[model samples]
Target: MQAVTFQAPGEVRVEERPEPDLLARDDAIVNVDATGVCGSDLHIYHGRVAIEPGFTLGHEFVGTVVAAGDGVTQVTEGDRVLGCYCSACGNCFFCRRGDFHQCDDGRVFGHGKTLGSLQGAQAERVLVPHANLTLRRVPEEMSDDAALFAGDVMGTGWHAVDQAGVRAGEAVAVLGLGPVGLCAVQAAKAAGAATIVGIDSVEDRLEAAEAFGARPVHLMEDEPRAAVKDATDGRGVDAGIDAVGHPDALELACRLTRKAGTVAAIGVYAERVQIHMGVVWIKALTLKSGQANVIGHVDRVLAMMAGGLLDPTPLVTHHMRLADAPEAYAVYDRREALKIVMTP
Candidate 1:
């Protein structure tokens, strides 16, 4: 099977790799239908997330179950499914507390050995562990493009808003208008936020955010803090989300939120970065940061997508054959596409 493999920084190669098979009673095997090239993939591509060379490199996937072990009861052979990016043991300490993202036995696909040694889904076939929790059937009406987001990007966006505790008639400001940022805007609206501000320098992204009912503020050309303040009537937003994994974005999110508001950092942060603790302490802000609890939120995210309350299909800007993954990565790296879906 041809799979996208990491070779070096800024490079991915489509090479023939062995197909995956079930390794446990809870495991299932899926024949790839469609997989996504996500912003997280860029971290590995740029050598920020160190993975072994030649490791299969993708996590967001929608496929048909080809085989399933006896313990896998949620899905059967031939079932159309979408998988969460990470797998978690349902009975673990963190899992029991509804923090599946921090499960002791958790494994993230395509993230190399440090994450779980699990190979990725960017191939003809991939293995799925904890199938009952990791895989969900795709809704009959959901397209592959839309179904894929329920597992990862959209779920992360929903997590950001969920953790922030946004209430109806409240205001939100999302720092960075990338896919996750745009999705955050949609989630905020679904949660009944009266005002949503999207910050980014990219004109296209700003436009997309506006289409999603957010007030677009250019990161450089416009003062985000002032815009957020003015929109919130001088009190800062009820919730501020930093979708860009940078110190600057985090700081801006803190500044944009009200004194008692929450700041949700949903972006990928792999290392230590300095933050102004004085600001957080002085404002008594509630700060929530970490990877998204997609495992715990997939059902809700899928329900929203199936109900038409959340739609991410517009975010997909490119569709290519799996063999063209190299070029797809290049396009994504160059910021030419938003979401790239590849079929095997």
Candidate 2:
């Protein structure tokens, strides 16, 4: 098997690797049909995340099961499935509370040893742990490109909206226009948000958000606060989502949300960043920030996709072969692609 591995900061290589085999009764081996280059992958690519050299470096994947242990009953060999970005023990403390994202023994695929030493799915074949909790069958009508998002990006987007408790006809402002940001727009729309403001500086992304039924506001050229207010009748949005994970973006999301509203920071943040507490205190805001609970939301997300309410096909900007991962990373780093799907 050939896997995309991290060589160093700003470098990745597709190297020949050993085939993965089941090591646990609940484990399964998947023949990866398509894998995604996600924004989270970019964190490792930029050396922000410490991953060992030769560590497989992808998480979002759609594939067919080649083999499964006797304990794996939800899916069997020959099933087309999508693997969640992280695996969780179904009986753990957090899992029992329906908080699988905080499972004590959780492992994120493609992230290195610190995250459970689980090798990634960006290869021809990969091992999957906790198969029942981590893998879900892809709908027969769902395309590979669309199914892949259910495990990660689209799931995160749904989480942002869900965590914020966006109600029907409520207003939301998604502060970023990347793949996740755009997906957030769609999710908000599906949730019946009457007004959506998408803030980003990139022209293409802004356009993409508009196509998804959001009022696009340029981060630089356009006044996001003013635009949001105009869209909300001078009141800020019911919820604000900070999808950029930057300090400035977080602050802006807080500022854009109405008083006593919620702010969901769904983007990846590893370091301590400062935000104005006085503003939050004055507004009596409810702040929620962390990794998305994709495991908890995958079924609902897939159902939405199958019902045609959520479509990520337009987000698939590039498709390349597994062997060309080096160039793929470069293209993603250059912001030349939104969601890059690679086939083995």
Candidate 3:
């Protein structure tokens, strides 16, 4: 099998590797059909998130189940499947409470030994741990391209809106317009937000957000704070989402949310960074931040995707063969593509 491997900072390669087999009673092996190149992959590509050399490197995947262990009951061999980026042991304390993202035995695929030594799906095959909890069958009507987002990007986007408690007739602001941010815009609108503000610097992303029913605001050219205030009649939006992992976007989200409103940081924050506690304290804001519970939200996200209430098809800007993964990674790292789907 040919898999994408992480070499070092600014490097990735497509190399022949051994195929995976079911190693646990709850495991399932998937014949990967399509896998996404995500922003997280970029972190490892840039050496920002350290991983061992030659480790398989991708998480978002849509494929067919080639085999399943006896313990896997939710799905079976021959079923079309999509895998969550991470898996959780259903018997854990957090899993018992529906907080599967925090399950005591959670393991993330393709993140090297630190995350779980699990090989990624950006290849001919992948091993899905806790199969019953990690893999969801893709509806027959959903395309491989569309179903690909259910496990990760779209799930994370929906988590932002869910965490913010977006309600009908409420105003919401989503900072950043990457694939996650664009998906956040759609999620906010689908969640019944009357006004959705999307902030980004790129013109194409701003245009795309507008097409998704958001009032796109250029982060540098336009004053996001003023725009949010004006849209809310002087008060800030009811909820603000930080879709960009940068600290500046997080700060802006906090500032754009009204008093007693919620600020949901759906972006990745791995290290300690300075935050303005005074702003949060003075405004009486409810701040929530962490990795998205993508496993927990996959079902709902899939439902929305199947219902056409949330379509991320447009975000698929590039479709390339798995053999071209090195170029795909380069394009993605260069910020030239929104979402790249690699077919094995």
Candidate 4:
């Protein structure tokens, strides 16, 4: 088999690798048909996330189940499946409370030891752990590119909206305009937000958000705070989402949310950063931050995608063969592509 491997900072390669097999009773071996170049994968490519060199390097995947362990009863051999980026042990304390993202025994694929030491899916095959809770059957009519987002990007986008409690007809602001941010715009629309403000510096991304029913506001050229106020009659939006994973975007999200409103920081935050606690304290804001509960939200996201209310098909701006992962990483790092799907 062949897989994408991180050779060093700013470099990735496609090379021969041994195929994965069942490693646990709840594991399944999937012959990957399609995998995505996600923002998290970019972190690895940039060497920001310290992953072992030569480790398989992707998490978003859609494929057919070639084999399954006996304990994996939710799916069977030959099932076309999509896997959540991380696996959760259903019996864990957090899992019992529906907070599978924080499960005590969770394992993230492709993130190396810091996550779970599980190899990635950007290859000919991947081993899915806790298959009954991690692998989902793809809807027969859904395209592979679209189905792949259900387990990761789209689910996280939905989580941003859901955690913020974007009520019908309420106003919402989504920071960033990357795949996750654009998906958040669509999720806000699907959740019946009357006003959706999309903030980004990229013109193409702004245009894409506009097409998704959001009012695009350029982050640098435009005043996002003023834009949110102008749209909401000076009260700010009911909810705001930080999808950029940058401290600046997170701060802006806090500033743009109305008094007593909610701000969901779905972006990745790994280091200590200053936050204006005074503003939050005075506004009575509710701040929620963390990775998305992907396992918990995957089914809902898939249903929304199938219903056409949340379409991410337009987000796929590049398609490459698995062997072209080197170039794929470069294009994504340059911010030239929105979503890149690689097929084996």
Q: Rank by lDDT, descending?
A: 2, 1, 4, 3
User: Could you tell me which residue pairs clash in candidate 3?
Assistant: none
Candidate 2 lDDT, 1-344, residue by residue in tens: 89999999998998999999899999999999999999889899988999999999899999999999999999999999999999999998899998999999999999999999999999999899999999999999999999999999999999999999999999999999899999999999999999999999999999999999998899999999899889888889999999999999999999999999999999888899999999999999999999999999999999999999999999999999999999999999999999999999
The digit string of per-residue lDDT tens for model 4 on 265-331 reads 9989889987788878899999998999999999889999999998889999999999999989999
The RMSD of every model to the true structure, in order and in angstroms, is: 0.7, 0.6, 0.8, 0.8
In model 2, the number of clashes is 0
Q: Which 10-residue span in candidate 4 carries the lowest summed lDDT?
A: 244-253
Give lDDT: candidate 3, residue 329. 91
Q: How far in Å is the alpha carbon of 313 misplaced in model 1?
A: 0.5
Task: Tell me the TM-score of each prediction against the true structure.
Answer: 0.99, 0.99, 0.99, 0.99
Model 3 lDDT per residue over 74-97, tens place: 999999999999999999789999
Strongest candidate by lDDT: 2
Residue pairs clashing in model 1 are none
With a 3 Å backbone cut-off (N, CA, C), the pairs that clash in candidate 4 are none
Q: Please give the distance, in angstroms, between residue 238's alpha carbon in candidate 1 and its true position after superposition.
A: 0.6
CA error at residue 36 for candidate 1, angstroms: 0.2
| Better lDDT candidate (1, 2) | 2
